[model samples]
Target: MVSVAMDAVGERLVSRVERLRALEQALLKAGDRGVRPAELAQRLGVRRQTIYRDLQALADTDVPVWNPARGRWAVRQEQYVGTVRLSIHEAVALFFAARLLARMADEHNPHAISALEKLALRFPEPVREQAMRAAPLLERRPRNREFVQALECLTLGWIERRKVRVLYRSARGRQRHPYVLHPYFLEPTAPGMAVYVLAYEESYFRQFVTLKLERMSQATLLDERFPERDFDPVAALQSAWGIMWSSSPVTVRLRFSPTVSRRVRESQWHLSQQMEEKPDGSCILTLRIGHTLEVLPWIRSWGRDCEVLEPPELRSQLAEEYEAAARLYRTAATADSVSGLRPSSGRHPRL
Candidate 1:
């Protein structure tokens, strides 16, 4: 009885393998004119009649297989040059990305919406309508219009292998830089709302400049070639929480209050963030970054609820910024009282 069961399993396995081979061959000969059943049977070492049965089984699933003229099989052009058979996971990811793009109508990227449109076109009518409906419900915060456009233009220049002349205004004032830089990527930052450009400034001895998008004034794309540099932007960015240090990547540790901990856990602030639960239900957030500036403001934003458990530079910097801000408020209050400025009772100043 056991021997008979084993024989049955072996036959099923062989049948499965034969069907897989036929499917693979159909895909391989997709653009080609046709494939013969006799040839397919010989390739799979199966009987010609078995090959015919397998073709029928494949056809039942709506795979576009055709027997042209005399028992020669062909994968139809619609199934060949047409729709991509993506796994459910891949389809969902595409759907998610498409949804994000459709909502970013404010973004000047022509390709963004176009790409989403192409993905929507791939789906059936009902799925397409569902995606379209979900798009309006997906809310994205408005980005700085000028900044977004400039970044998009720079990205185009990068793709076309062109240089850009930028009139950048730092904290001081405007400075012109006619540099050939390989544009890597951009990162979003908070408080006064800044977007930073991570690019290799070739004219400046191949130095990496993290320029604030808000500071860029006049940007012109130039027809200049950049000598390729042996640098990895991703690895460089790995040690950063913000646009600060680039010297060496180091481990950073922080303790968050229960409130802040809950908030931080729900969001991914850094690439290398790891959280540990404390005994008192608080959270210890550890991150590996190259710069101190990244975590400084984030810690300060938590007020006295967050503490830097490691990295002295970051802790001190946060302390100084907090002190500076406190002093500014103190001075403002004192001056207001001295000038007999009437305090607006109902209206609080929006921070």
Candidate 2:
């Protein structure tokens, strides 16, 4: 009976929130004409008194809203939300950022798409047309309804300073586990093309843990509010090569061959990195990071051009991985040779 009552209350709260959003849109659309409380109530299927209280609530938040005349309400557009004025370079930068955002999101995200479209609408011409064309690119990606729901719940939890319960699966996990997380921050990674939530988990981690959005599902925003705590996300992730962060940082050194040395110098991989150029045209890059696990793949992508120098364990691990991969190819070559397969062309050997 208590559970049912709680659900009922939750439903009413959600309905009221939706109604408030609709009310704002209606008034904003009305502009100078203004909307009557009766019209809003009729549209939203709520009482006129409820619309009045909703307007007052919006006004309490300092929203530029007023009834210009009796029985009509409107948002003061000129004062409510000022016009955006962007120079050409600034406009181009924003357009590029929207393109990055579209690429970063795995699914069609309405909020991101709408934001891009709105920003593009105010851009200078030529670029404006191009920006508008790029805004709907995310619309083609398939929607993940469950992921959207989980994200919305987590967003609300963060804003309300509440705990959220989520069903999560780790990177290599076979089954989902429950976590009661104290919502702290929602972060994004461009290369990884995923979103992450950094939160406190008292049960397992006893500290902040990063949870990937793609791995999380079935999120519930709990009514339990948590006390405000000091957390500077920027400072926390200062040493992170990506989303992963920790208190301990390890020095990493890598030697790049002459072929890829300039390529390595072209970009700053990590903020803490330092370069030592060798006489043989090779260079050793050194950096401090919280963990080496996150950077192993990056090292492997360099293939033979990059060699680990400082961390002996990482060097040994990489060597073992290379050895294993070589053995697999060697085994395949032996099998093909015995089966009369041409060594180079992968065709039958001359009979």
Compare the candidates by lDDT and give the number of the best one.
2
- Write candidate 1's Cα lDDT for 1-351 as tens digits: 999999999999897766765565664564435777787878778788887887887667666778665756776643433337886568779988666545544434444445556666566778877665554432344445565567766765655555666666668755655455566666654443455777877766467788876667566666674555676666777677666546567788889888777787888878888989887878988888876665665676788889887888777877787899899988998899999996558777899
Candidate 2: segments with Cα more than 4 A from true spot: 1-85, 202-204, 335-351
Q: Tell me, what's the RMSD of every candidate?
A: 10.8, 14.1
What lDDT is reached at residue 350 by model 1?
100
TM-score of each: 0.54, 0.71
For candidate 1, give the lDDT of residue 254.
87
Clashing pairs in 2: none
What's model 1's TM-score?
0.54
